[model samples]
Target chain A: MRVQAAIEVAAPPETIWELVSDPARYLHFMSGITRWEIAGEHARGLGARYRTLMRVGSAEIGGLVEIVECDAPRDLAWTSISGIDQRGRWRLREIGPGHLGERTRVELRLQYGVAGAGILGWIAEQVAAPAVRKNLRRSLQELRRQVEHEQARAAAATRRAAARN
Target chain B: MQAQTARASSGDGHAADGDPFARDFDEHEAGERPPAQPRRGPLERLVDAAATVIRGRVPAADLDERDPDFIRESLPAQWLLASLWFRGEVRGLGHVPEHGPVLLVGNHSGGNMTPDTLVFTLAFSTYFGVERRFYQLAHNLVLSWPGLGFLRKYGIVAASPDNAERALSSGAAVLVYPGGDHEVHRPSWERNRVSFDGRRGFVRLALEHDVPIVPVVAIGGQETALFLSRGEGLARRLMLDRLLRVKVLPISIAAPWGLNVGDGLGHIPLPAKITIEVLPAIHLREQFGAQPDVDEVYAHVTATMQETLDALAAERRLPIVG
Candidate 1:
């Protein structure tokens, strides 16, 4: 099944990419994520691998996933290397004309299922769609909240620094 | 769960019924069998012939029979049963060793239809991908039952020391429930208890294999039906222990069969919320001594499991709603 969730963030795509690309920040902003560990030497960019697990229903479902597409500040995608078959992507787009840095639209899409599992697999995917979608939506809201809050904090710090100077 | 029947196969060309493990463990535990009543009637002969056929159907333990592809394909059905039907929640799977052979000792519950096993199997399979060689020990009866041949594909072999040793020798994790049919058919009021009935063969198995033992505690299965008794007396009088190698003829009040007896045909288990907790692995040689005492290890394991079961039981405010 395919599930996607989108939200508008005040910061630019680079800011969102910074948070999403760093494996360390996953547990903080990603809902239902139980484990997110760097599997190999490389941490980010193409070829980087991660052992990820997400709590869906009664099981922690995920596996080793490699970064197949990493377009820096715009798009990031990964496909499963083992465990459940999955393909996940993070898309970031400037919200409006000439307001690229001021606002951005972020979407997290995931396509996951057990290949060759037949009718029951199809049914299970349908049944698990709502939970997966909810987690994605919450994760986006959390990402927006953290990024916007960080930007506000940085702006306040800059104002205080200027006044002190 | 008292599927204490020993290895059905002696690895010889002879019939499995003549196997020593089946006779030694099954009959020794049940005591002396009563004298033969009379000559078999026509109905009795037919039933005997059918039993003989079923007994012949039990397959020999072949580690290669465990097909990871088949297990992966069947996981969805198991997941639906565990997630929707049982509403299972499993915690602390990380406590189990991530790799290598280890013994998983669990308390069995939920008569003939073991929902606990179903929930735990799904959780284990999903947690540690199907690629890992994970096997479960089941009673010969369960293995010989018609249409359950697919269970072999799920990596379940007849409960026997040789089978377990073989699985472990192959560096695969093996799950065993010492309580077996005895504790599984316990009265509903005693659901919170972890009664292994002094069977410490699992301790010996782990010690022999030189592997760690992981205790798996679960609750809410006994709530699936109103279990009345294990019916040991009836089984003794009927000589089921000697004839079929079955110790108990359980009686319960369950769905479709209001006054279910024997439960050989199984029954519909109520939608009980099952919660399983996997305790940390106990390296016997390290924790106990270089020469660990079987009795001590058994006591420690049972105590630890009972404590966890108590905590799970206390958290429950109701029976099947659990």
Candidate 2:
């Protein structure tokens, strides 16, 4: 099953990049992306791997994954080589100006393979497409909300701090 | 007579026009002529003609100077949408106490610095009925427009420790966007992407002023504005791109990027709604001089801001805007 969902992030790409590209900060922003620990010694850059598990409703699905690409604040893409037939990519493209803040068009693309590689794969793709798309959409939106809220909080702190100085 | 009987508009009124239904008929008091049934039009019979003239036909430019929302909504709201528009589902607005001077410290994105500030100001004014001016500690460039006209007009002083002290000292509700330039271009969507290295400004100011910090979490506001790609070098050929504080991209990214000055900022902003939740006021008394570790206070406040944001995202419906 292949599905894609994106969220218009008011945050700058750099802000989103800090949260999404860092393997350690996954739990800090994303909602259902659980079980992100190192698979090896490397923590950042390409070829670094992480054992990952994502929560889908009541079910938990994951596999060992390796980073194929990592471009800070711009692109982070990965493929599942050992898990339950999973593929994930996080892409940040400048989409135009945002409504309230600056907007970064965040596209999260995922492809899932069913048990069979042929007809059954097609069936599974249809069945899982909506579910996975919905999940990814919600997750990206969650990430957006978290960053912007933090942005506001940071602003307040700056104001207060500036006051003292 | 108009001055003696004239009433200052009360509450957050829409406008001063009397309801047409409020027309009265009482010409018999001064004349042998029977009074005309007070038709809702101009009655040569009364003294409120001035009020009526000031009513529906009132010019937006003439609105009370302190209440800018009227002028904003009346004349500029539509035009403002031509560039960018925002719709925030403000939650926990009541957490902002209406009693005394309160300091609102919040996270701000570099791509869209002023969104959170504007939304917070509207929410506060709408709920509190006071035209509370949120003193913004803006950058020097934003104030130095042309010859610093905009700043002088709107009363935005530079962001400094002294300005913060002055605003808080005057018992006014002030707001600050602390992320500065770095936070603006940071990671795309991470909430805790980066920390303010020397971020003790708010904490120190609050402790010094003895004011409570009202922590606000503006979630998903950054989804609307975007920074496509940064240039290879920070060239210093200053112009409008730098003036507007947006990077000059070689390629167009945002929806309205190619549009002109009057085009409706195209619907690139997905329907993801914005939810602004006001968390409990964080008190500085316990650790002002007690904790002694400014780093500890910064970490604590930062964590709280993140926690509040996460909770809101998990619990509330996501937002969608212009």
For every prediction, compared with the true complex, DockQ reads 0.68, 0.01
Which DockQ value does candidate 2 get? 0.01
Question: Compared with the true structure, what per-residue lDDT tens digits does model 2 show for residues B1-322?
Answer: 0000001121102222342111111111123223445664343324244334323232221112333333223212221221134545455655766566677777664242345544555455434433455465554334333433332323354454545556677677767655543344344445323334344566656666778888767665445545433331332233222223322222213455642121112225432345566777877776555444556766887788878777766775543432
TM-score of 2: 0.43
Candidate 1: tens digits of C-alpha lDDT, residues B1-322: 2233223333212224554444433433444444566987776677566656656676788889999888888888888888999899999999999989999999988998888888888888877888889989887778777777888887888887668778999999998887887888999989999988877778877888899999999999999999999999998777565456567999999998999999988899999999999999999999999999988998999999999999999999988898
The runs of at least 3 residues in candidate 1 whose Cα sits more than 4 Å from the true structure, single-residue gaps closed, are A96-101, B1-55
Kindly report which residue stretches of model 2 are placed more than 4 angstroms away from their true locations once superposed: A1-165, B1-85, B110-113, B146-155, B191-198, B228-252, B258-272, B287-292, B315-322
As for candidate 1, its interface RMSD to one decimal place is: 0.9
- For residues A57-94, write the lDDT of model 1, one tens digit per residue: 88888888999999989999999998889999999998
Error of 2 at A70 (Å): 70
Clashing residue pairs, backbone N/CA/C < 3 A, model 1: B1-B180, B1-B181, B2-B180, B2-B181, B2-B182
Q: What's the lDDT for all of these models?
A: 0.85, 0.53
Worst 10 residues of 1 chain B by lDDT: B5-14
